[model samples]
Target chain A: MGAPLTTRGNAPKQDRSRATRRRLLQSAVACLAERGWTGSTVAVVAEHAGVTRGAAQHHFPTREDLFTAAVEYVAEERSAVVRDLPRPAGVREAVEAVVGLYTGELFRAALQLWVAASNEPQLAPRVVALEARIGRETHRMAVRLLDADESAPGVRETVQGLLDMARGLGLANLLTDDGARRERVVAQWAAVVEAALRG
Target chain B: MGAPLTTRGNAPKQDRSRATRRRLLQSAVACLAERGWTGSTVAVVAEHAGVTRGAAQHHFPTREDLFTAAVEYVAEERSAVVRDLPRPAGVREAVEAVVGLYTGELFRAALQLWVAASNEPQLAPRVVALEARIGRETHRMAVRLLDADESAPGVRETVQGLLDMARGLGLANLLTDDGARRERVVAQWAAVVEAALRG
Candidate 1:
């Protein structure tokens, strides 16, 4: 399949541009996780990505744009993974799966953005909307993976409670490894979740 | 009963100093809750407290000192409230008390600082230590209030789970009222806590 001369000429350049943007976004996320909002300025992220300031600015004109997009980009990736995940066979596995979603680098990055967004007027609305969308989707995923009946009274709240607990666990992990204690907590939750669903 | 001239002269001045300090700390918390860490500068807090910048600085030499002290001051007050609270009659009431700790303006003020502290190097260690102490005391208070027997297997994790769930609920309430949903979640948690403790 032969393409027109103009199309062929532009393909490599467009690919290069896309690759650069990806690098910047990924670098932004890493920077946010390690240094937080105060340290993850556009120039720092640009240097981290090995891209010119001009190129980063061209891709994302504002600090808000770059950071929010960075979180959103990674969030979308996570969402896709959750969607493609195989259905859990039991409550324990399902609990593990949902808890797994909130305990890593991406969560750290998002947490930084969230704190900054709460204070930054320009950044607040976008981050809030993005988070609300993610919250709804994650709840749906939990319901689906758990194979629980939401039609029953008290079921939705139980599921929401689990999600909130997972988030708090994630918050705890930010300060310390919290892995050992977290496992205990998760195991306990798995039991609570099963009994709630069954009853 | 007559006091010396020096002691009499100093007492009112010291009273004024203590009053000024109290006003500043309260103002700092109010600012943190409404405007977050960024907007709640030393100057802004001074203005809010109806104190001079000099007086504010006299009490707290740096921004970190002021904000951390603000949170700590409020936290100590809250701790007093917790310590003095009558023991709950049952799991449901105990859960309500614990969840109630994290859902109000104090929690919001503390949250803003927690996020800010996670990023600010100077603020991190103090805030982390403060939170750890608070976490321990709160945990102990919860144990006492719930009448939990920690000797039982999984009992500790169950209590910790309740705490983390309460924090997650607090986080959720930051952006939205989440009242109706929160009531249901807390109701379900009441049942869960009762079973976990009984088992």
Candidate 2:
């Protein structure tokens, strides 16, 4: 469902327009989560938002635009959660923070996006770009927390490896439904990445 | 497209039966790959296979059955490839073998299955179970290659971490199309895992 918008013509209802856009984006997220990428369409998004398809289209002209916006929305939400997180004192804290964030609530929407992108070529590139941004930002966080120089041999790859494990473990936990085991696995992950960086 | 199969009463020929199944499975792969899980129906599978819908239904009684067989077939193919690979002499070789194979061709098919499973609740549990089996098997292989006991302080997590990274990097590469960089990343991954195990 597309969010209701208060356009220039409806100056007094500008807040309504902003509200509509927000509703539409939220509806799109629900639709994507429910239907996967290919199954998600403008019509469905509109229906989900409880708005007319025309209204949905009025808010977002193309499905691609909606999808791109939704991804950005997800990324922004994730970034917001981690933004104020305390900087890790060392490798363990950094690893724990990264793993914890990834394995927690912050990951649900992004995982949906990841699954969607896997099958849709048109969607894959954009999702990949978004992920690349996440990777770069996360690496920066790791560098600050680990006190590693970027130019140091294997520093980037070391951090990348940690991110990779976080993702892998996330998928594994989702698939396996072993919450306790996943926690153990994640803690173990923190240990390995910590060990790797020490050397 | 569904395969052209002979009736149970009388098979067309042994080789022809094999060919029919092969064609049907290939069509299923193509259809699923092109359309995502929801888009790939038995009728579409049949059409893609150049066979009749009736024939497809006759050979595979249910769409779930057909999809399950298709997944198993792909898993078997991957298992075969891994089996045929020469035994690694030590930790480094084993990690390299697993990472290289995973990040290459095997990763694409696996990602498709992962994406497909997300849309099919019926398929998700089974797919998840199969993936867990694979994870455990890979972990076992790592334990053997590294000559580490399960009781070893960090062996299990380290092995799990390596497998996790292999999968994470594999999926990331498939989505991002950063093949060359992924290769380097996997190589670096192997180095890190080897280092962890050694420590």
Which candidate gets the maximum lDDT versus the true structure?
Answer: 1
How displaced is residue B28 in candidate 2, in Å?
Answer: 3.2
lDDT of 2 at A21: 80
**What's the distance in Å from true for residue B68, model 2?**
1.8
What interface RMSD does candidate 2 have? 2.6
Against the hidden true structure, what lDDT does model 2 obtain?
A: 0.69
Model 2 docking grade: acceptable
How well does chain A score by TM in each candidate? 0.94, 0.75
Write model 2 residue lDDT over A121-196, tens digit each, in one string.
7777777888778777767766766666668677778777777777777766554565676666667766666666
**All candidates: CA RMSD (Å):** 2.5, 6.0
**lDDT of all predictions, in order shown?**
0.87, 0.69
**Which digits, one per residue and each the tens of the lDDT, describe model 1 over residues A1-199?**
8678879988889999999999999999999998888889999999999999999999999999999899888888888988897899899899888888788778889888877776777888898898898789889999998998999988898899999888888887776578998898889879878988897
Clashes per prediction?
Answer: 0, 13
